[model samples]
Target: MGEPDVAANFFAKPQHLVKVNRRRRMNIWRSGQGSPTVVLAPGFMAVTADWARVQPALARTAQVVSYDHAGQGFSDPGPLPRSPARTAADLKAALVRDGIEPPYVLVGLSMGSFEVRHFAHQYPGEVVGMVLVDPSFDDMAKRLLKVTPSDQVWIESQFTHLKRCELAAKAGDLRPGTDAYAACVFQPQPDLTEALNKTYHDMSLQASYWRSLASEFSFAARDKADWPLADMPLIVLSAGDRERPPRPPEEVEAIQRVYADAHEQLAALSSRGARRVVPNSKHAIQWDRPQAVIDAVREVIAAVCGGPA
Candidate 1:
């Protein structure tokens, strides 16, 4: 939100943006001058602006750059079957267009993790480090993404609740003069004025609209990453709590076991691999525990960048 308008002010001069003629501009939104460039890949149904709270802080430490994926956020429509391969290409092209010279610390969340994972595996030299915030591994995640008729109910419920929240915030029904706004802000979700809520909601709604594109590409073969090892300094932050419906004690145990296996496998692959849990957080661990994420990224940079931060 601020970056698009403030790009000129933040960098002391109007930042020039050029559309990517290649890839049909599938990747859009680029600006900023900084080193050790940080490319933030957002989770499913999220826009780059969703990172507003953390970008400024990250900008202070490094040149932080995040963009809306194709068919999501403010970006143009993307191709069908929004697989990891296509997303990775968009990220690569976007970075190149912005003149963000390589050696990036790719940070991805949720489905966006698929993009970063592919990016790292394909272009190892370009990536200096990796920060996966509750990333979904390709093989493991695909199983859950499989949509069934029942999945529609959960999806519809979330959509309705989010839209209502957006409307309430936009109408000023909740404001400083009202206890509603105060209480809403203190609630588990982000502090959104009705207007801000609507804006963010539009971003989410737009992203979800492209869910079909993801589906189209769902059954395609993976891009052949034998071992996504993540050889560089890596920080993997997984959701701390598995507190959702369908979670019987046994189910929870199974999830923990899978996560544990994933963590252990990464450790065996990289000496610098580190892992942490975003305490009491849900699937949107980044939003739920922003500070913990920032801290984890700092550690990754410290490990990879050298010197005492």
Candidate 2:
């Protein structure tokens, strides 16, 4: 994707920009009041608003902090060539700068789950709990390669599409799937405000945002092999009702089995980790079954607080 200067006239409302470092300013949204803050980490190309449905509910019990990583939403574009380690470190720095005290319960969705794991592994003492929502696995690339011959095509097509998005953004033309991206990432529900809808659409059109996403996916598996085994309260929330693409039944089932196995392995990372399959929900569990996300967060919060789990 073509690199562009950070948008000057992006957000309407006044928001806090926590300086994670001299070069990066991370945008963070906070609500509620309590110890053991619940941090919401969004998926690929997702912004803080993606957690709109679940954040409010969790805020009722404990402090909730939802943030956009560098190059997403209104956050400043970070140094190029982003990796999960850099993202996690930036998040930790921002949290410290914002004065959000720890004993934190991290809630991560999709690709964001890797950053959460990195944070927990790097700063085990700061994190008390975790909720992984339809997490992406470390060995996803290797597994997809072995699935089928077409899987290779699918993987390559993602990079191709990302390049096209970059070109379109540079030419001031919104990408073909901008609407679909907005609908999936931001407007998880039907009643999204017109202003919010427009914000998501604008963000989706940025070439820098797509480039950051591409970089994250490209190097996700490299540093993930040495994943740590932490002793903390962890919940692996898997989607029980994921949409099946048009593929042979055997291949589809094989992919699903691999997903199931990966999630189970994630749960085993912690002695306190447990796996839960949310019925009638897909990858975007925060949108389809927000209550599940809220419950998982609360369960973790409770565990950390020595309350009923």
Candidate 3:
């Protein structure tokens, strides 16, 4: 059997550069030819290439496009002060710049979900529906702190470090995926070892950009007025396994509970949406469990493409 390669050539190519903001230029990847477009967003520390698992599945139904975010992969080093809203704004610009009209099905995974919600809120009219894979609500992180402030602070600090690593990776200066990220996600896929290793190595180099990015997180952390987009039609997928190593079983459970609550928060956002659990998957559900990602996306597309039903 052939190994899964999310970045495999599928007769698609990047056609143009969309200047999203002062410093962000989104590299748009495209495939298929149809209406009711679908735009994809990469996860934290991952470039658009991460969707290598599911993008082809989506291209069959609609115009599917994914891009590396600024300071992440294939994109220019974005301006400082990047947040959920700012990222969403960059997405809107990328879509427009690429000639992908509105009324799109925006699919985001993990960290990408945060930005997806912001995009739906910013351009509700343009978004027809959404698919949130292992979603993350802004307050989701805060839940961790509730248990023990120290734990939250530790995670916050870790997240800060990873974001820095991501920037370095984007600049082609270091590795991309971390060891933990690899052990949990990449190692499962033996076929993409070389590519995965490349991504992992690339992400490792982004520490150079951490200082400026740290400030952006503070601003992005600020809450938006209302979650108008949160209520948009969405399909949220959850991972079955939520284990963090070296931590006690109880500690792992606590993290799962936090993710569970976040999932509930995500489901609560939409009257027209539903949630599903992707079994035996990790944070990188799309890569670790590609079929689940495809299945969830199909469900969402069906709802959107379903005619008057």
Per-prediction TM-score, please?
0.71, 0.87, 0.78
Q: Which sections of candidate 2 miss by over 4 Å?
A: 1-15, 171-191, 221-226
Q: Which ranges of candidate 3 are over 4 A from the true structure?
A: 1-16, 21-24, 159-232, 307-309
Candidate 2 or 1, higher lDDT: 2
lDDT (CA) for every model shown? 0.60, 0.78, 0.66
- Model 2 C-alpha lDDT per residue in residues 1-309, reported as the tens digit of each score: 221112322232325788898887998878788989999987887776677678767777789898888888888888767787788888899999999989788888998888888888888688889999998887787875677568777777787777666666767666345653432233322445555556766676777877777787676544463365567889999999987867899888888988898899999998898999999998899989989999988888777888963
**Residue 40 lDDT in candidate 2:** 90
Tell me the tens digit of each residue's lDDT in model 1 across 50-80: 5655666677677777776665445666666
Tens digits of per-residue lDDT for model 3, 212-271 = 345445543343423644445677888887547556667767777877877776777778
Which pairs clash (backbone N, Cα, C closer than 3 Å) in model 1?
A: 81-213, 81-217, 169-194, 170-194
What lDDT score goes with residue 73 in model 1? 45
Candidate 3 RMSD computed on C-alpha atoms after optimal superposition onto the true structure: 5.3
Cα displacement (Å) at residue 161, model 2: 1.1
